[model samples]
Target: MPTGKLEWGRILGRLSPYTIQKGFRYLKHFGFKEFWIRLHERFEPEEIPYGPWYEEYRPDPEELEKQRKRKWKNPPKISIAVPAYQTPEKFLRQMMDSVLEQTYENWELCIVNASPKDASMEYILREYSRKDERIRWKKLEENKGIAENTNEALAMTTGDYVGLLDHDDLLAPNALYEVASALEREPDTEVIYTDEDKVRGEELEHFQPHLKPDFSPDLLRSNNYICHFFVVKKSILEKTGGFRRDYDGAQDYDFIFRCTEKAEKICHIPEILYHWRTHESSTADNPESKLYAFEAGKRAIEDNLKRSGLTGTVTQTKDYGFYRVKYPVIGTPLVSIIIPNKDAREDLEKCITSILGRSIYSNYEILIVENNSTSQEIFDYYRQLSENPKIRLLRWKKEFNYSAINNYAASKAKGEYLLFLNNDTEVITSDWIEEMLGFCQREDTGVVGAKLYYGNNTIQHAGTVIGIGGIAGHMFVDMPRERSGYMHKASIIQDLSAVTAACMMMKRQVFEAVQGFEETLSVAFNDVDLCLRVRELGYLVVYDPYVELYHYESKSRGAEDNKEKIRRFQTEIEFMRCRWEKLLKEGDPYYNKNLSLAKWNYSLRPKD
Candidate 1:
């Protein structure tokens, strides 16, 4: 066994023994609040006078040297901004001491005071400022609220980047050093955020890993996963004009979205670097705060909608974050649903019926391309369906080429949008049209697809995991419903690098812009190729589980047995190598590198 795997095995070996027993005990004792807090403070340097309690323990000299060597670089100047309201005096002093003791020397501290009644806060700030020139203090006559106070502190930040720290939150000793190193590595990054743990009183309770590294707008749109203590470029912050006072309760989320829009790049530091205090009064402790958050979030979404020039109305749904959008019918954006088939006329009929019956939006035409069907029944079925005004039948006459057939259909399409629907899939949602159309209608979105599942209720296609088993393929093949795992188990809507062509929708303009699919590669991996090209053109591809469908793989066509499956798989591998060389070089935009996928292990074929 290799050393790395061997070491991992050994650790895991020991873990399994205590994990069950100790895990339950730990959960009962500390809870998520304490666990989250302790994980972050675990690595924080303890030399600071005050701050979260770091148990008295010194790291081995060799390990300390390794840690120091990892951060060898020109550190960017980082300013820690602490907006103090009515926080305890001890907590304020502790926060100051934590900053002063950071291993990364190039940092300044800005304390914006919003407490007029407490002279102790001012006294502590004055004493800290007097002790360290890097510490700066500003006092308000009255409480300006946390959001406003944060804005006030924003003006005092002169460093390359600004780090948000609540008066009560504590930073690990290497927090600044880790961020500085990450920024140094990704110089173009405008925002650098880290995973954080929550603290309750003083015990470690839970760990929330923010391991997602890719910069995805859709991910942010869905939830504020990149929140908690984050370092953002000062220039970008200044440009966005700090937090919007209008979004008082959710100002941080608003500011983050606007800042992300202006930022060209972002980096996620995988380590837990900040300790978030989780008291009963804190937002983490209260669910009622969701109302304000929702309103602010809605405002942010409205702004994005207007900016994108999409005509839609948002309405609240019973589900907390769930919403319904009614898109007004402007001039009909003609849509063509392209389907490829060989045999299985019954399956095709069902597929077509679902679209015609369930679609809330009208103004779409279906194009069924017959791929050399050797069945007389299939020929008669098309003849019977020719009377349907919205359905068009095209005969491929030659061999079955999934890519070529779609490209041929697209060339004949009169619609402004192209939808690829597989004959084997049955649409289950009434809002499928609106769900996909909303994304396809957006100028920034290129391709949109629906979630697919087997007849057994297990997932069939949520998204594709590139570089899986020396071949990039679909993930969550047949997993039972459980915790929302990586393949969008919990999310109804998400941004994916590629969706199954089994049921995909795209704007005709984007399809034409990328010249549709590469006809050389037939059925497999063509969706990934199309999506990659679309993304390269600066458009996002989204996968929405809201429009659910049952996909009986290759049911419309005769299923190739083992020998043909291998042959087709080999062909797909070669095609993927030729078309997706860039993705292989920089890595798939969606696949998490730390994950155990088969595709990440190989060097893609050399680009021509």
Candidate 2:
């Protein structure tokens, strides 16, 4: 691993001129918040301060031993396949040892030697095979690529499930044990994957963890987040015909996409079961070392899209591994922009003006849900705004129930799509409406949310993460706006459990299907409640970072610091718990259980 000083220097050296330019823009627009966060991030990128949950998930040897003895009703034998091509002696031994040390004894380690000339690898494989009956070894006649080599290993496996293992990687001692446990619970699970982290340098310090979500098809299209600790039913693997040679660099990704399409049930084990070794040649250490991998990844996504009958153009982003799928608007449907405001005329005007001035989408209307604004200035501004044919003012005489207000406004909306936008948010992206509409109009998508920044250009809500702050909270909150978050999640377009109502767009049919937002959640967590309810109906809630906005967060409603507001907030929290207790306790499907629930960003749960 690089030393602290050396790592800091490298980080500085990689800082692009574009980042510096964005920094200056943020300083001018948002003031000191962006500057302060940038400085703090530069110094302490990995040292994120987390709450009690950080200490709660420490690995326990006693627990592992207990799990080892636990009886399973139906524990399927797992066949782990490793395609070796001149693998290092140390790494090769470690890989073999990790499988041999599995707590679940019903597993076979299938090692296929692609490099027949590598005497050291052959000797080690033969020695290990002789020592353990479960260890299977096969020497190839000639050296094929990773795809063909792995396929050869797959043919030798007889287990119910076939697992993929890297030649230079290490699995947690209890990795196969966890896989068996999950299968015992859900026997029909066709595909299973786990979170992973990188083993850096000679010291093998664990870092750069990829705490992945459950089965997310959209997220899979963005990038192969399920790159390691991957297991699939042998039947499913056969149906997919293993990996393709054309996508050799991204063979796993292509194979996974194909398998998932035919999979009946997909399961995710939220544990760091795999440690990806980051050597100089490894993609984890330097992505640029194999640019062909990214090109293959892009092709994988594009092929998946074509197979799924979705019309989209897949292209690589500046972030090497990440991709952007641009789905064209299906039709020119009228999108109603629903703004619920009380008194902030200036904020409301700014939001409306930005939409009118910057938006390229032609078919849209603005609905101002007037919730008892007392100011004469606000009334005057409303009267002037109502002059436009596209704008209309609706009155809500009752109390400030966010759900009730939006529900009332949605009922009166004439557009095919309803966009529940906050009055305090200003549009940053010129094609923000078009970008959101494309996703919302999709048959599978439920709700679409935009990336929001604070007045200081720090992230306010990249997306909503369930179980954060004990209920749900905005993801990547307070991070510098320009930075791509963990695994480029903050910048990529993907499926999430929930998204903030601050700038949410959805089709009229979807809104009606979920019956709009829950009125019981009057103030706090109403958006989350609505999103959860929407997800319950089997539709995906997406968070698109391409649609950018500046949200002077809650500038109209003010803070929840006062006594009455705090009481109401607490009541709403209880209401959400009472309503969606299963989702909260079991974990968000769009988030991993191993991640810290206390922090908004994807921080690792610290060991005690």
Candidate 3:
């Protein structure tokens, strides 16, 4: 939301030798067409300053005064717990001062000091306690550990809600006010968390603001996205039993999982209310400093999986802090790979060959639906493929109606799980089917999508986003597979609003529950509609980057070049807009509002 001229000089300065290196690599590997497209997508949007944007939307003095004076009908008191160690005088003062400056007055700060050696902190806390009665302090003779220290602070709180605050970090003036507002909006909410950013130095120069999506369970398992500005109900905290010493390095991550699982209604406030201060010794400044914390995070995810009545081996991904869970395929359930094909015998052959030859998971049947293929060679290939017991050939006499053809094939499928695939796609990962099946087998997962690339090394579809290109578009389109998306989103597995049906998997019961894809959306948006409807039925659509495939996009059906095809595409777009009017207007919950919908990349929205 920056409102000013583009600083071209500063923007060009960011194009370092690394940028040039990537450009040359792209040109050498992907050719000029792809190189130009990738370059445009990366640099077309101006890189705006988040500091100015924050300052522009930040609440003024008069607004804060109004919040301070507002009377509430039984406002729930929020108790903040701070566990302190060897805290510097400046940081300790700032942390306490940030709480004291809160607009909401019905709050208390419970400080459990383990910094016995730092005598200066004792004097600071005593002075603050004298100045404000809400500031309560307790000095522990010995540092019991972070988990126990937080528990000691939690024991001191008497409010209805409890919040955790790191001693060196800071809370924005509106942090407590937002929590109170969310409680009024959703009274049954047992857990509430806000987005946060990293700040440094005396002025607290803001950067790396995390504009998070709605509460996503699958995404949380991938990484601890909800690490800051967190608050929970007093009852929920009591039920979770605070934190455990075993997960001391990553106790907050473990505690968050426990709280969310116990809460009936969890709310997310999309505001940067916490500033995680980074200094020399802080893990935020250097990830390599505490490798043990990452291992503990992996354990926390494993424990959550066990609690959910599932088992998986959680392993670290290429990204340092991020992790991946390889859930074992339970009981070898049959998977139906349904492909709707026309002519393109070569394309269909490649698709089936990859599944039969490269696939590591057996016990899958391929149902190939032939939709009016005129070529004699395709029929010849089909006749040869019919000999295999694992492959079944079905006929569709009607014109290319994508939804109806798939629905008919799905009705005939005998498997418990259904996989919708495009004939133009060839499997790249050996265990691609198993990779997707692992996540799809989860009770909460309704749809699972694989990471797809174009014929070249560039990406075709990582996931789908609503209201991107009028209705919906794929994320990370044309980006090289070697590079990651914004904030390494391309490299991580997370929950999304929608995924391309060209390579999607879901339960057979779920497909029937939604009555299959909407027949009205014959070609375009049919997959997105099905995914959205599945989500409405309280299910998550996960995009796993580990499942890889090469998508020769539209090779069988060809492009929408003719007049009739273009008209049909336009009609589908209008249909999606009318059907999903609310989502388009309100924005996608899986995507952040601050990000630009103008492009597939998660770039900053230009505030003109």
Flag regions of model 2 displaced more than 4 Å: 1-45, 48-68, 561-563, 606-608
Please give the lDDT score for candidate 1: 0.71
The best candidate in terms of lDDT: 3
Worst 10 residues of 1 by lDDT: 599-608
lDDT of 1 by residue, 166-279 (tens): 888778767887788788778888987776656655454433233454666666666566676688999998898888778877788778878877788888765567777665
Model 3, 1-608: lDDT tens digits are 22224455766886667556645755775578765544543444336667787787678899999999988887899999999998999999999999999999999999999988878999999999999999999999999999999999999999999999999999999899999999987899999998888998788998777888889888898889999998999999999999998998899999999999999999989888999998757877656567788899999999999999988989987455788888888889999999999988999999999999999999999999999889999999988998999999999999889999999999999999999999999999999888889999899899999899998889999899998978999988887786666656776889999999889999999999999999988999999999999999999999999999999998667789999999999999999989999999999998888778988867666655
lDDT of 2: 0.86
| lDDT of each residue in 263-282, candidate 2, tens digit only | 99999998878989986578
Clashes of each: 16, 0, 0
Better of 1 and 2 by TM-score: 2
lDDT of each: 0.71, 0.86, 0.88
Q: Judging by TM-score, tell me the better candidate of 1 and 3.
A: 3
Worst 10 residues of 3 by lDDT: 37-46
After superposing candidate 3, which stretches have Cα over 4 Å from the reference?
1-46
